[model samples]
Target chain A: MEVTTHSAADETQVWGGGNKPLNASYGKMMMWFFIVSDALTFSAFLVSYGFSRFKFIDSWPIADQVFTHFPFLHGVDAPMYYVALMTFILIFSSVTMVLAVDAGHHMQKAKVTFYMLLTIIGGAIFVGSQAWEWSNFIRGEYGAVETKGGQILQFVDAQTGKRASIRDFATSIASERTTHQSSNGIWYQDEKALTTVTLAEVKAGFEANPNLVIRTQQLNENDQKIDLSRAASLEKIEEAQLVVEGANLIRNEYGNRLFADFFFFITGFHGFHVFSGVVINVIIFFNVILGTYERRGHYEMVEKVGLYWHFVDLVWVFVFTFFYLV
Target chain B: MAADAHKLEIFRGLLKFKSNVQKIWGVLIFLSIVTTFEVALGIIRPEFLLQDFLSMKLLNWIFILLTIVKAYYIAWDFMHIRDERSGLKNAIVLPLIILIPYLAFILILEADYIFEVMRNGIVSWNF
Candidate 1:
């Protein structure tokens, strides 16, 4: 509340023209400033994710169950393995990027070029792995029924205590169901693509199966979905309104549509960053090969970009924890 | 032109590296170990970690803490913030320290309140 005016000498001492206050170049300082702001943006996204998770705290889909598919290990419950591998890939790329920067410091042109190539390769693989993960998520492994109240009722083999795919039990019921286009229905409206199985068929299959029990989205004390008894399962099936096969912006076989939305938004955003980082790395790698930095007598560009690459890796560390581990 | 202007010590000088390249690899190995441990704990979901503490599972707390540790090394070592002057380090880190937790507290607390209202209020959310 008290205003104290400093002398002009004090002002000049602080401003002190021709001095780098933080002892960093203008470009590097700006990169750090950009990173700081970007970090805040990412934190906002993650904290909102936390908000949504807390809101649906009781019914949030278990990360273990949702992300169980591993590449080439189909039908096996290998949760977190693929994501863990992705994490390692991204981190390894960060290492190479930093090493490239270190080599740049020593004026080792060939070493910088070699490490840059490795970093680029690692980044490409990481992006590829992410694309595969997105595909698997979009094409969900097991299908579930969506109740009229938007609750997800997943099928489980009670005897085995494992997930049961709707395809395993859904009987083929011939029905005159056609996709409604603008020409067929109202000119202004069209139906979305239909799931492989219809609700009626799912209901009929449930009636025919004695071993299948319905697991509600709600979690019990053990942090697992609550599976209904046989009679309760039969009763719960009556409330089913639609068959959900995979994830999209609207809904998912996974419980809580918000979960899928956040997953797509957050990871998709991070993946875009990785994509751009790879592009940036490729450009820098080319410059390194062209001896541009060598002729310039410094490799500050590589160091600046290395900061960006390492920041990307840092974000993934948090994303991995919040999205998968926590 | 000594790039060794960058410090060689990490873990508060408990460990020191001979070269920047070796330090990069050291941090990489450390991060990998943290990630592997996180994945293992996630898969196991040990009985003790399931207990609720401070409105969250102990396992979740561990995950968040380890994640912060990983983030620290990535920023401080890999990004060369440890080599930066203290002014820049504070400029980069202090705001995050003050603001992220503040935002998290407010938003998460409100979310929990909404959850309570949805569970106990006149409107039935679960059918």
Candidate 2:
């Protein structure tokens, strides 16, 4: 951008070496560019999620029924509350991050440190909440039977219209069923861990119970899952081939197996981002405490990292809307 | 590294905060309110919203639009994009503006077409 001589004509050019055309520091501008790219990456993941969701619009699991658990509120249908709280925590952390950046602008070292600490704590809490959510999803509340055609059949109490857990109804059968391991099975073959209850046990229990009805994955006019008649429930139970207890990449008690795959991939990716963001924030937090920024005559490092932290929160807003709210 | 003065107005200059810290908190309140509204709608799921609108539920459209609003405030205010010069802002936002919707539209439309084929064609998926 430098010209041979300092002249008015040369100075008129926006790219003249002495001035910033965008009026932002090189590092800050680069951070903004990085955020734009990362935003597109997240948009791709969410859009593909939408693609699969619409592809299986008729049979996709209802997010509410899947994520109804809240910490310390057992058996209560608290939907969207935990995710909403996570959203608030991340947003509040964003607020504190900005406050830290503003304090940095004013050269207030202690204030910056305090806000950074708050931001880190909030991020840690969010990540922990996500881990809990993952656990809840992996260890499903109500077990379901998977048909030979790969459709999930959930049981509901006809009297109350609430989900019925297999554990409550499945009769314990004294059998010698055991998980196949490498030592016990053929040298080259090993089976996955056995589910808590076998399919035969479930079928026998369903035959014994009169109040239980089978709920299909299909949604009705009011967006509720369709419950089959008692006779049809008996017939459907005959089609059961495997007992699905929770979600994994291959099987999900919730609904379509792809739902579990997308849930694990997208949210797991976002959780990883939050984890790294927290790590970066902690690194910067120590720098703030050590007066590194103070010695450098600027807190621009904190500002750049603040931009990234806020971007993570921004991505979560979309994830929350698409994954949970929608 | 020079600290520039921030533009304190939000909502197209309809609302203003006295200081940067105050603006941060104001945006926080606004975002929290929007999130609370979304969660409430999700839980209640009003009957009218269950109706299909342009092939998707109206409630979903509302959630997407409100999510965009939340994302805008978080990016513009919390990330200090609003304080940036017009050139910098455009440079950062223009590409996404042109690209994200294009990808969503193409993918979602194709997915719908696939759904149609699976429904109407000889192949039976719901066995």
Candidate 3:
């Protein structure tokens, strides 16, 4: 690139490196490279997630059922609402970021600062909402029993199509319940959290409730979970070995542990990006407030960061579709 | 940087805004509307979309298409790709346009094979 630029300048020719290639500055060029590479990385993660979903096509958890909880609307079926809100927050932040860049182009430091502040706020809200979503995912709403072969068995009311939690039905036995700790099983390993309802209690509760049925993770032709009859439900409940309440690296109340694994990995990676983006934005925000870019003769620095901010928001569009909508 | 703030506009030649700020809001509104549509389709799961098309759900195809639309506007407008020269635009976008689908194809094929094996093998599904 340096050789071409030198020769091009000598001949009054155009194209390739040396200050500006196609009129893009060095910082902006490097930012574009970073964005393209980072986009590929995210594409790989999402593609692998798709691969896993296809592998477990019949048993993959439905996004609507898993992400139904909405803030301040507990117990109401609000599927896809919270995630939709998060997506809006991120895209809105991207808007502010581009607006900041626009203001920078005109050398309007005050507008840049105002828009930057709004961008930071939007990013903060998005990151917070993601953390909240993760917590809710980890602390699942309806507990299910995990079979010895690692399939999840959830209980639902037959009369109404709504889900039923173990806490609502399980009658606690006097028997002592314990999770694996250093003293219990592995001398060095410990379990995440103890399951509140024991498998035995869940099994006993299924026997008591005639209206309840067992819904296997396996989907029927209708693309819904296969509902087992009373007798089959009793038969299936016998194979229950452990109670799974939430999600973790090892187990998930949601069907197909791979589902939770991809959720954690992809969203966690994206969340880390947002966190770092927010940190970078705060630093630049201070610089804008302090007239640093104003004195630099140009606000190219803000434009470079704006590229990154928009890229993150762009990735979320795909993530929102792959993880939630699709 | 000599950035041209007004050159970047979204939705192709359609829906041109007078200023960059207005264009940003226009893109934001368009993106929001697309998202709302995606969410609504996801929840409703209409009968026609539920029917399998080309071995995939029509609804999923719609989601993917809308996602790509949102991604394009975000790149072309918010990231100022449209304001960039064609050379720079192609340099950044060409690699992704070529590579992402290739990776997706191979990975999805492998997963499909794996699923076939599981379905046909002696391995029990009741676990």
Candidate 4:
């Protein structure tokens, strides 16, 4: 037979000086440590975002203009509303998660189950909203001419703050390029055909519609927008291809490319965390339902998983503030 | 026995919030208000404030401040760090606090250098 002896110091060391009567376990402590480390990792990402913003201080894309798209509102200007809703959903989930944890403390199994289900629903909704945002971003809105200099000059209305596209003002050209989709041409299956509407066609269209005005890449000395006053000058510049409306990197009809990049990197990362968190929570949830901890006469497993769920919620709070709110 | 009584009193005090639901909701509502304020300032950016602040724009500063406030609440309340032991809390948080700012400062300084190079370098690289 094995014999063991324990002292008061050992009891205190194992149980946190008896101050915490909640009877948390080693797994819970480790989870807290993991959360802190993960939080630091997220902080690094957000801080890098800030660094980049400072780098492009003068020409950074406006967040409102970039993230203005809302579901079922085709071409309607709605800014920050969708993201705000996502934030609310995540926060609501966090609340449900805490309620579940509180119920766990009291060993109310049914209440824990209900709150956990609510949390899962919230996570699903948030992930779906993110997917919608991604699809809209990838499917760009207005096409523009890419410059050899790699600089983008977007079309803007002088009278209104709305964006304009080539299709809005220009008609398609009769002339077509010689390149075909067959083996002879520069091709990799030719997934999509290039735009048939040439600059010449646009010029003709502009001439036909005198109400339309053209804005170019070049700015005057005062850093203000300049438009072509003379039809002849416009025609000449159109022929040379020197005054084509440039592509928009910031506040385009689709959205800002930087916004897409940040969204994918930051929120995608957070989403991955949430996904893993759900997987872990599901495992523990099943265990709780099966009464594994009940067999052992303790529910510490629930507390451990609860800590992790709360950590995931905490990270979302910061992401909401920096990405959506700020 | 006396020590046990003291620890119980401390535990009771920690759990003295009206309810877990109420506490969580209170934090969420506060966070929402702060976010709304940030968005409002961003949209209705007043002219006088922008003109006054030279080094850092008032709008940008406000965003940064609000962000910090949000971070603090998230860490303290949501993560339950406020209820943790002082030693454990410092062991985790203090290092992160020092290191994050240090890393941010270095990265910002480098970014500024790159900006200067782009602005004044002999070979023109237009943004």
Candidate 5:
């Protein structure tokens, strides 16, 4: 390949006196610029996450409670372990990618191929782990009862912080069904069906089950959990609301609605990036194995991809810290 | 010529950082320690520390500080930013540093306003 430098005045000048201190190639410079722009995009998402979190500061569902599921080990209240593992996988992949780039520098084709393969495996594992997390999130564990005031009242065992499900609290109310699917007399299927259990049904059930108690929206002065007083005024206030069944974007079994939204948006966005990154990596991997770079007498393409892989890993670090840790 | 060859060997040794194997292991160990610290802070949530800080909880502040440290190491060592020129590093990072915080501050302030409206307003706005 020919290396040429145009005069500083030239629009497409590859090198200039101002750029003398840093002797990086045009491609590397562009990659840095791309990374900066991408970082900003991620920052915007994270900042929005922070904003939402602050908006629902008092009632935001605790991260540990929301993401409590561990794969295979059902009912285990493992928090952040899966995400930590995912972080390790991505970071390890980044290490392998860097190693591959280093091997490329030394013209060690076999070593480069080996490290690259390992990197690909790591990426696949991280992506799989992410999918598992999404499944767990989408299929919520302990369902809650949403009030008319848009507050979720989740049942928790007073002794254990583990969430108490509706199954534990309320028996399913049996309702008679019509023979054919009709619109006028029966509720239309096309239109969204109202919740099966009204607040009245739930209240009656609660009254029947004296053991079952209410968890309120307001936190105590000390920010500790406050059990609802069986005051007549409170009972009247609670009776006026609705009882939502399933978890939607706006609401979840966990008291906080924003929790589900953030989980979906952040993880979904990151997952999409990982999917695209894998596709790009696959293309580059195939090209590497095919000796494209060897023919070109430069392995800078591998380095460029490695940069992207590292950036993905970098983003995960922040996500893990913000979403899982604090 | 002999001196030049010796110098080249020394340069290679420096690049290798005694052993690339040892360095990789060291980085992994360091990362684990940082993560452990973060988890420990979260689990423990020391009362004294909580009482001392306003808005900035000790656990949260620790997580943020550790996160910044991790980001620095990842950028400088893993991404080879430390090997790059100061000018290149500043050019890439400074804009993001400036814009991101500014955007966060404005958005968070707006979210605060929304929160106040939701809390105090007579009329209801669906969250």
Candidate 6:
């Protein structure tokens, strides 16, 4: 086909930015693009998490067992209650965000401001709850001993069938436990301070307390941890290598290091998304007050940001299922 | 976009004062109920659902399916995708629909293979 030299075709063409393909604005389409790519990124993280869990299918830490701490009530075993509340709040915030967008569509400025404010408050509360959760997970409730082979061995009372914490039964033993400093060791190579509670103290405590039994991380057919007999418990305590207190990148008192690693990376990544969503919402919130969308004759900007906010909530839905429930 | 209302009828009456706000409240209540149901099931872990069905337990499949339902409402109502033009909706959704299961199948298959290796091969199963 021969091209026209007059260039009159340019005037008649609908492809020159005038026509909105798919009837979506450029910004909305970009937001969807970001959502798809980001969704793929999260899928990778979760699937790899699935991979690790599958590898350790029998010994993987149960979500119900691990995330049992409740805020304010220290000793209560409120499994999934706090997370459930957080899920409700986050979903409600999504509702408020969409309400703001709906109000924006009707050019209702006051309504838009009100709903946007609610969304901001909801987001702040969710973020604060996550920080608290991380604190509890890091601080930990019951400490465990890491065996020489990198397996965690917890203590339990044979009679009570309740979890025995390190603080409860472990007796303190005076050993030449100097804080491993880089100065005394391999000049340039230094390690962090050794665990405050030494293995000797734990072993002595275990021997003295006849009721204390060793519980391996593996689960029995009934989904309960198997406890070693007194004889085996004493024998197992001899293999204790390190005393672990809480969760970190390298050590997790809960069980697997990979579990904590994925927990931090996936949740931390999601928290970052929520944080940025709040920041963006704030910017748009201010723009609404400045009559920016009003001047533009439409509140499409509010709608655009609302899409992102909802996407964040959608991601959390999956996170809640895989992380907390499954 | 304002010309079209939300597709999910349950959320159409979310606000008590009536009008379109009702839709918002309706949908919100629906989602919260679904979530509450999920949390309840998670806590209970009924013995019947624990029985093996096809390779996975019925409970896990239920959790995954319910989770997908929640995700749908968030996308359809909260994100206003239901109000969007068909072409745009397809553009955003079809790729994910095709990609997620494909990724799940492929990655999970590989993971199962790795699990087999750890169990039977030279590498010891537990640390």
Which lDDT values do the candidates have, in the order given? 0.91, 0.91, 0.89, 0.63, 0.71, 0.85
RMSD, one per candidate, in order? 2.6, 2.6, 3.2, 6.6, 6.0, 3.3
Q: Write the per-residue lDDT of candidate 5 for residues B1-127, one digit (tens) a residue.
A: 0111111112224544444444555565667778777777766667765652546467777788798788876776667676677789899879988998899889989988888888898985432
Better of 2 and 4 by TM-score: 2
Q: Rank the candidates by TM-score, best first.
A: 2, 1, 3, 6, 5, 4
> Whose DockQ is higher: candidate 1's or candidate 2's?
1
Cα lDDT tens digits, model 4, B2-107, are 1111121112255434555566667777778987787677666767556435456666667777777776766666555665677767876888889878987898
Report the C-alpha displacement of residue A216, candidate 3, in angstroms. Answer: 0.2
Q: What does candidate 1's lDDT look like per residue over A68-127, in tens digits? A: 888788788888999999999999989989988889999999999999999999989999
Model 5 chain B worst lDDT window (10 residues): B1-10
Docking class of 1: high
Candidate 2, A1-326: lDDT as tens digits: 86667678767774556687688998999999899998899999999998998888888998988999889999999988999999999999999999999999999999999999999999999999999999999999999999878999999999999999998999888889898888985888889889999888999998999999999999887777999999999988998999999889999999999899999998999999999999999999999999999999899999999999999999999999988989
Better of 1 and 4 by lDDT: 1
Tens digit of lDDT per residue, candidate 3, span A176-248? 6577788877799986667787777888888999999999999999888988888898888988998899899
The all-Cα superposition gives candidate 5 an RMSD in Å to the true structure of 6.0
DockQ value for model 1: 0.86
lDDT of 1 by residue, B1-127 (tens): 2587878888888989998888888888888898888999998889988999998999999999999999999999989988888999999999999999999999999999999989889997776
DockQ of each: 0.86, 0.81, 0.82, 0.38, 0.44, 0.68
- Per-model i-RMS: 0.9, 1.1, 1.2, 4.3, 3.7, 1.4
Question: Which candidate gets the maximum DockQ versus the true structure?
Answer: 1
After superposition, the stretches of candidate 1 with alpha carbons farther than 4 Å from their true spots are: A1-16, A183-187
TM-score of chain B of 4: 0.77
Stretches of candidate 5 exceeding 4 Å from the true structure: A1-21, A158-162, A177-204, A221-225, A230-246, B1-16, B19-22, B52-54, B120-127
For candidate 1, the per-residue lDDT at A173 reads 98
Please report how far candidate 4 places residue A141 from its true position, in Å: 2.8
Alpha-carbon TM-score of each model against the true structure = 0.96, 0.96, 0.94, 0.77, 0.83, 0.92
lDDT of 6 by residue, A1-326 (tens): 99756466766675455776577888888988999889988888888888888777767888987899887887888999999999998998999998998888789999999999999999999999999999999888889999877888988899998888887777887777677666887888767767667777788888999999988888787666677898988988888889998889998898888999999999999999999999999999999999998899999998888988898899899999999998
**Docking quality tier of candidate 2?**
high
